[model samples]
Target: MDISTLLAQASSKWPQAAALSEPARDRHLTFRQLDQALTAFGQALERLDVGEGERVALLADAGIDYLIADYGCMANGRVRVPLDPTLSPVELLAQLRDAGAALLLFSPQYADVAEGLRGEGIRCRALEELTVAADVDLPDRPAQPPQSLASLNYTGGTTGVPKAVMHRHASLCAVLQNIVMARGAVLGDVLLNVRPLWPIAAVAVLAHLLSGGQVVLGGRFDSKTFIDQLAQQRVAFSSLVPTQLLRLLRETGSAPADLPLFKSLDIGAAALTGEVLDGAFSLFDGRIAVLYGMTEAPWSCYLAAAQMKALRQSGESAEGVVGRSLFAAALRIDRADANGIGEILLAGPQLMAGYWQQPGLTGEVLVDGWLRSGDLGRLRADGQLEVLGRCKDIIRSGGKSVQPGEVEQALLSHAAVREAYVFGLADVEWGEQVCAAVVLEGGASASVELLVEHCRELLSRYKVPRRLWFIEELPRSHYGKVQKKRLLEVLGVVAS
Candidate 1:
């Protein structure tokens, strides 16, 4: 069934269960209350003359209002186009124009931007205004077909122009199923979601609710309070990007022993180096897991907590291990080098319908029913998937190809290197030379010479970074994936 049906089913099955919560605002909604709110917002959309299947763009922070707009748009057969608040108005406008949004709904914080969009001839409305109770009932609309559009999620635009990944009701339902199976969310499971609700993390929020579980929106993540919330809410499941996991480790020392209620923590959005994984495992008592996928097909692979413990006990490096494909997804390698690594290919019901309004671009990735995932990976004999870096991120140094992830992992193995990003810089002699931008642990320093020498011991000659820059933090997208293509511009380094 579709997302709307799924939420309705949850409401019917557990009318009194806590469906959503915002601890910061002391706001909470039970299943029946959430369903009513969704219905009210749907009626509001109808009153605004937004026809069925028309796009409604949501640009607001994660909270009760954003939640209503998101579910209401979908439940009422309207396509939800989520705009990243972190993006500039130019970028946001580009997506809005691309999606052909019938209306733009935003919170009070975005009033200035909404006014600017209105000046540009786009219809804008305050999200809270629409949340007011509608006295009249909205006529029941026919259920959309499973293939009907559900949302337009734009890419992170880390590399270049952002393309909206078109997700259908069927594909998103598949994602919900995969998440439930992979994360094992029980009826009473409590999931603390601090990640931005506009991205893939929002799916996790839906997955939990659809499974009759409670979701606590833990506003902006403050490591200190994050721990307190876990203990207070008895949160059993949570997800984090690698960046967030790293910060939690540094700021909170280790997962406090008092947090016995906390259970699963899945890390995704970027690869996890062995160093960070080990530290997180220690901090969270092996509750950490690895989730791998893209905007095109989220929840593709999952490295569960038990498997992570086994991998660690086996003394194998967990650096690139992103676990096995989910039950509904199939994965393969397209072309391979001598080392058996190649671009990862994914085929599944959860795959995005295509890039919205860009059939030609969609043709590039969706070929023969399998998504050309652009990510490089190799499969272990035991069926686990180990993702290398992106194929676009490979460094051609002196006629030899080097994967940046391998070098970055080696750099992270060093005591001082807290975070490392490896990329290629144009060089006349080597064609392209490996370069690095690193963030050291607090109060820790390492010479570029020392880091280079350390890499030489772990990587081949061509793979070691010839040049390195120490920075306070790596540039990242709102979703926490490193923006590799922007490192040079962000670091103010020019290619030789």
Candidate 2:
């Protein structure tokens, strides 16, 4: 089913229910009002000569306007390409060119950037300027097949250049159905969303809408503000990456008593160290789930709070437990070694059709019916999955493959360490040496010798980091994944 159909269903069933709201602006839309706005905006797009299946680029921050435009595009059968406003003009232009976007719709905040892109001969229009009369009749909704293209989602370009992952209406619907069924989401549920809407996290918005739940949109994440809003709105569900969770824990210092209304905090987009996980469970009196998926295929594996607690209490390592596969997906390890470490492979309806306009690159990853996830992981005897690290992130030290996640988790276990990132640096004799960057906890102190001694107790000699550097914070992508390439640049070393 198309997203538009889902929205229409929600609107009809609960016309008076709150559909979307921006608490910062004190603006909200009832289900009926949101549907009307989508229809009007869609009609406006038709008047602008935006043909069906044409690419329409949206460059705006997360707000009411972005949501309306997104839904409007869906209603009109336009392929929406949401761009990260945080990217440079050069980066944004590359996406615009890659998608062959015919028109750019942006918020007032990005007016200057829109003009700059327009100066490069791209057609641009401010979203505020695209208004239609309230009584204007919307054109007939196009009859789009389930397999029709819906959105072009671009990668965060953390490891390399960004590539567009093509998603169809059916794939997204399957993902939404799986989530709604798994979470038991209902009309009264409220999701507090603080991440930018351009990324796959926007799927949360769609999921809430599909389940007839309310969405509370916030601009950027401020730990104090987020917690305050969560309490004020009595939000039931939310998601965060590891970096954001760490910051929230540090800022709050202790859990507030008023956040009991919050039901679940779905953590994903990066790995959560054991220290962070422990702190999260202690601070939040709700489900703390670790979600494992990529832009290519969401809803692959979900480690729920019960499973997390069980693993902790049973003394099983929580370092890489991403739980079991979703009901709608199947997972396997390809070419597993003696330890069961291998590249993860997934097959399901939620998989992306292919990388946009990159047939060669698409063929490399998507083979037959499975997506080669390029992530190194192992399946436990209990059927749980442990994502070790990325295949490309393995460090070969003295002919031994060292998983960065294991070493980083050990460093994080140190009382003085708040965050740690491990990478490989070139060495003449060893070929590559394990190196680490660590962020110390507030007012905590530790020497390199002390940290090395600590690692020696837990890790093998070769698995321990050979070099370590203390830093204020590790570099992270917009989605909060550690940018190893940027770390190498920060350390004044080029990757070999």
Candidate 3:
């Protein structure tokens, strides 16, 4: 299953069942129509001589055309690198230059950014012009093996560099299998792929299309409509980050009309709080779940709704568990701190073949066929796993250690607190200070003293927020993960 097979399969099954659509644009392509669009884009890329294995950059808004260019690259054996278009030209150029990409494909809206890179000896083209009518003499490209390199998705590493996580066709196929097995996804499920496609889990949405399901395509995400879409499209499956889920649950109506048609809700891309997990589970009647994976390992653990419900019924909270392994993937909690909380290491076919062009870095983490996940966690005797926090996010203040996630959990449990992020800031006395920034629910405001007092009852005094600030909204990436690094910058908080 080269990723292209998904689109090919869909076009074969229900060519007229609306394969892709963006309601705002009044633009849609049936499976047959989608095939033509992909052919046109492939032919267009062929004319440009975008060779096999060459890195082609796609910086554009999410839509049907972007999907065309992505699979079109797969169809032509070219490795596609999808980037968030929100990046500044400087940051964008820095990555392109490092990738050694010969050709850049982007929408006309980003034409200025693409044009700016031309002076740097980088060939760039407007993605709008990347496609042409069927008459063009596009070169013939042969099919590629499933193990051929699929794409290099960039993610920030502990070293602070934008490391490319290499993924292959086989890895993606395993991911598809894991998704099908973990989610029980089926052909008739309506999927709204509203999250950015840069993250690896997003490939699962593409997998749904490949597995012959209805795909409601576009990057447009509106909470009101998102909640409405569940009933409107009768959407059975959907994926979103905690932030998007937060907004969706906060819709104006106490109980939105379409709140109940979902068969599955898979959330990832960031740590989901107990607040969000409880809210989502209760809202969907426990059809919601949290998927744990990274760019390097696409589908790893799955925490299903049943597990969460059981935990709650047993007087326990599904507080921090990311879930169990999916699709034969194995997980072992070998790291411990006298409490059995250690790093989670995994081994599976779904793991990335290696970091693209970063073998030294790959070797450092992938030891003996296992991925040494940098996350710190513990496995309960019953086998449910609880992720405490990333190794880097655990804060040490004075002599005691603090997991920022714990503080955040306490803050969000408050009815007035809509969202919270905790991190260590510089302090002359304690060596490091615990700080928090919260967004109140529904524009409601809370006194800083009152907020701190509430944390005193829910959290340890040391873990209580020393600094608290209210913001209209928290800064987030397109995929809805908080840009904690950026948030710290805005707060003028510096790590010691």
Candidate 4:
């Protein structure tokens, strides 16, 4: 069945159950109301004379309205182009043109940008206007096929030019199923989602609804508010990136005392450091689950809370252990080295159809049925998957290959370091010198010389950072993944 059918079935089975809520705005929708809203959005599209298979660019923050627009596109056989709100106007405009979006629906907060798009001769309107138009009666059309295009989600472009990953209704459904199974989602459960809806996290939100659970939207992820909302709603399941989880532990000092009903906390987007993992276990009582995947294939590997607790008890470092592949997913280590590290290859029903309008680029990644994940990883003896780093981010210094993650882990082992990012930079003699940017713990200090000595003890000479920069914070994407290429550009080092 298509996404529309899946949602419809959920709405029908639990018509009165809470489907979505935004506590910050005091907005809520029951299953029945949510289904009706989806229909209304479809009607609104019809009023705009937006036909099936046409692209609709959605530019808005994470909220009930954004969800409506996204599902509305899927329900009406329209292609959705969910633009990252963090992107600049130029970047957003480029995506709109690239996707050939028939209409641009934006939130009130983005009215200025929408007006700017209008000036560029693009058809645009405030999201609320669509809601108003949806109030009228409109006939329902036949359901789209499972193979129909559902979304055009853009990559973060950390490695190269960002391309939109195309997904069909079937692929999205598979991901939702994977999330539901991995998170133990159930009827009447509650999920507090603070991450933006434009990203893959939206699928997790949908998974809850499809499982007859309530999804409470926590807008913009304020540490204090997130804790309060969790305690207030008695949330059963939630998800966060590593950065958000770290900030929660630092800012709150401990977990909320009132989370008697909370069940699981899913962490994704980046790897968690050993220190952060310790803090998480101490504060949350070992309810942490680490998820690993990308835009093209969401939630491919899942490390459950039980496994996390086992690792902590055994004193094993979390490091790059992103857990086992989902039951339906297959993992392969391509061109493995002596230690078994290699580029990760994934094959699953959830893999993206391809890059939108870029067949050649898609061909590079999607070979046969396996998607060549640019990530380098290996399977551990314990059956867990250990992701080393990006294939593109490997540093070759003085003809010796150095995994930046390996050096960064050594630096992080030092007590003074709070956060660390290692990369390759240009050098006259080495061709590419290993460099690092570090963030120190509060009230902690360490000179580059001391850190270098510390690394020297743990790493090979070629792997140690030749240069180090101490910064208050590293640049990060909206989802908390470090933007390495952008970091180099900011440091005046040529992008690798």
Candidate 5:
């Protein structure tokens, strides 16, 4: 189904139902209202002459406008490239310099951030000043053909340059299909977007909206606002990364006694620890589904909710499994020599079309109709997918190999530790040594000695951290992923 079809269907079938909300601004949308906004937006884009295949960059926080600009581009089939609202000027410029978008639809709140990138020579706008024609005649902007370019997903720069992965319209539809199948989400299912509007997670939220369920739009996941929305919006389902889920559980605890409205939570994007998952289950049992996904394909693989509860009831470690593959995506563990580890290969329509303008790189990963997920994972005998760690992120300590996720999971299990990251540091003697950085919970102190002893009970001697550094907070991206390399540098274990 094309984006135009999704919008048109929603407008026709659910004209009076709320389509979006900006509770903070006291602004909301019914289906008819959303339709008006899209028509006005399409007309406005026509005013700027945004034709097919043109790139439209949306630089804004998650709100009504962000979805508006995003859907507007989708409706007209303009490739939508979302910039993190929290990006620095340099960060924004790298994107601007790369894509050279024809039109930039930005919000006033982030207006200054956009202006800072003016040297890159791209047109930018505050959504308020942009309007449709007075007697707006909606120009019919067709959705891009299946083979046409649809999105440009930029990965964090490794060689000091961010690379955008491009996908065809068909591949984007595959992504939506995988998401719907993965979430078990179907018609009449409402989803919440309390996270950023970028990334693969956006695919799920958008599909829910397009499939006739309402999208409860909001900005950053403010604890109070989130709990209130979950209660008032009658939210059936939503998605989160582990970090966001941690904070949401804390907020949901303060939810009123009468509230039991939330049905399910789709969580992924970080290593799942026993403490975190158990804490999530304790807070919202039978409702949390930790997912294993990649931006390239199967945005979610194997949902570990009901399975986790069963495992817990049976006195087993439910946290060990990341669940089975979504309906469309599949996983297999072929590299046993790496200790039951294999490079995950995602094959399905859900895979991306290719990396934008980087055909060589795309060919390297998308081989034989499978997207080689750089993550190293294995499948349990019962068909559960267990992610060991990222291929590059796993630290090699004197050739024994140390999966930071294992050490971090053990560290998080400590009552005093709040957050942790495990990395290998250069060592003159042992080649590379395992170093861990941690944040103590509630500012409580814990000695590395205690932590090491705690880990020795659970992990092998070499798998434990040789050195530890305590920090107040881990450096995270806007999406709440710990930047390990950055952390190692900040702790003086590695050169910046």
Candidate 6:
């Protein structure tokens, strides 16, 4: 069944219930109102000649208009390509062109940026202009084939340029089902979402709506505002990347005493370190789940807060503990060595169809229905999974592959070290040399020699960093993954 059909059912079941809201803008929509707006927008798109399977690119920040345009396209049977408005003009244009979008929609704030894309020959429509009067008949919702393309979601571009991941209607429904079951979502739950709506957060929005929950949308991530919303709205659930979590911890110092309504806090899109987890547990008296997945497969594995507490109490390493696969997903380690470390492979109903307009690249990763995650990990004896790091992130020094995550974990184990990023730099003799950049905690101090000695105690000599630099913070992608490319750039070494 089409996702829109499920959404229609939700509106019918909870007509007066809050469906979407932007507190900053003072905009709120009940389920029935949201459905009506979507139908109106769908009618407007139809009048503009937008058709089934057509690509409509949306460049806007998270807001009511964004959600309207997204579901509007879905109701019209058009594939919506949501591009991050924060991206560079060149990057944005490249994706728009790659998707072969038939029309472009932009919010009022992005009118100037939309104008710049006029040269691309695509029809540009202001989001505000795409409206139908209340008296106009609503367009009939189009039938969406299960295998039809739903959205062209771009990857985080941590490894290189982002690829447009193609997700089908059925696949997305499967993902929603997995999240609803795993997260125990139910009617009347309130979800506070501060992340951008282009990719990951969109899934969260769908899961909440599917389970008949209220969604409180925040314009941008302000730690203070986020906390205030939790208390003010009695938000029951939220998702945050590690960077956001750390920032929140820094802002609040500890979880606010009055805000106890928040229930589940999901953290993912980057590795969750022990230090971050420790600080998070101190601040928020809620369940903190560590989720692990990529653009190709979402909600694949999750480590619940109880498991996290158990691991910490057991004094076990939680460096890459991403927990067991979801009930609807299957996970395996491909080409394991004696230590059972291998590339993480995933197969299940929720896996994306493939990358848009890149069959060669799709062929490289999707093999025989399994996605080559490019993430190296090992399944534990108890069925939990530990993601070591990306296969490409392995530092080859003197003929041995040094997992940067292990080195980073060792560095972070130091009492004074707050954060650490490990990578490889070009070395004529060694081919590639292990290098590290570290940030120290407040009132704490550590030297290169001290950190080197610390790693020496935990790692082999070859895995120890040959050089180290102290920095305020490590450069990271929007998703919170450390940008090794940027680190190499800072060191004046061109990454191979």
What TM-scores do the predictions have? 0.95, 0.94, 0.87, 0.95, 0.90, 0.95
Once fitted onto the true fold, the runs of candidate 1 whose alpha carbons sit more than 4 angstroms away are 133-141, 158-161
lDDT of 5 by residue, 1-496 (tens): 5766667777778888877777778777777777667777766787888877788888877777777777777666788887776667778777866886887878878777767665467788787555332354344445456777777777754336677877666777777766666566655666778888785556677777666677877667776666566768777787777677667666666222334766677777345566667767776656777667666764647564676678678886676477777776766665655466777767777677777777898889888887778877777777777777778776666677778887888898888998888877777777778888899988588998999999999999888888988898898765567777777668776631
Q: Would you give me the overall lDDT of model 6? A: 0.83
User: On residues 73-142, what C-alpha lDDT tens digit does candidate 1 reach at each position?
Assistant: 8888999888888788888888888889999999989999999989988899999998864455444434
Clashing residue pairs, candidate 5?
166-356, 302-324
Worst 10 residues of 5 by lDDT: 131-140
Worst ten-residue run, lDDT, model 3? 132-141
- lDDT (CA) per prediction: 0.84, 0.83, 0.76, 0.84, 0.72, 0.83
Question: Whose TM-score is higher: candidate 2's or candidate 3's?
Answer: 2
Q: Give each prediction's root-mean-square deviation over alpha carbons.
A: 2.1, 2.1, 3.4, 2.1, 2.9, 2.0
Per-residue lDDT of model 4, residues 440-466, tens digit only: 988999999999999999988889899
Off by over 4 Å in 3: 5-17, 32-40, 132-141, 157-161, 253-256, 259-261, 305-316, 411-417, 426-431, 438-473
Task: Judge candidate 2 at residue 376 and give its lDDT.
Answer: 93
The model with the greater lDDT, 1 or 5, is 1
lDDT winner between 4 and 6, please give it.
Answer: 4
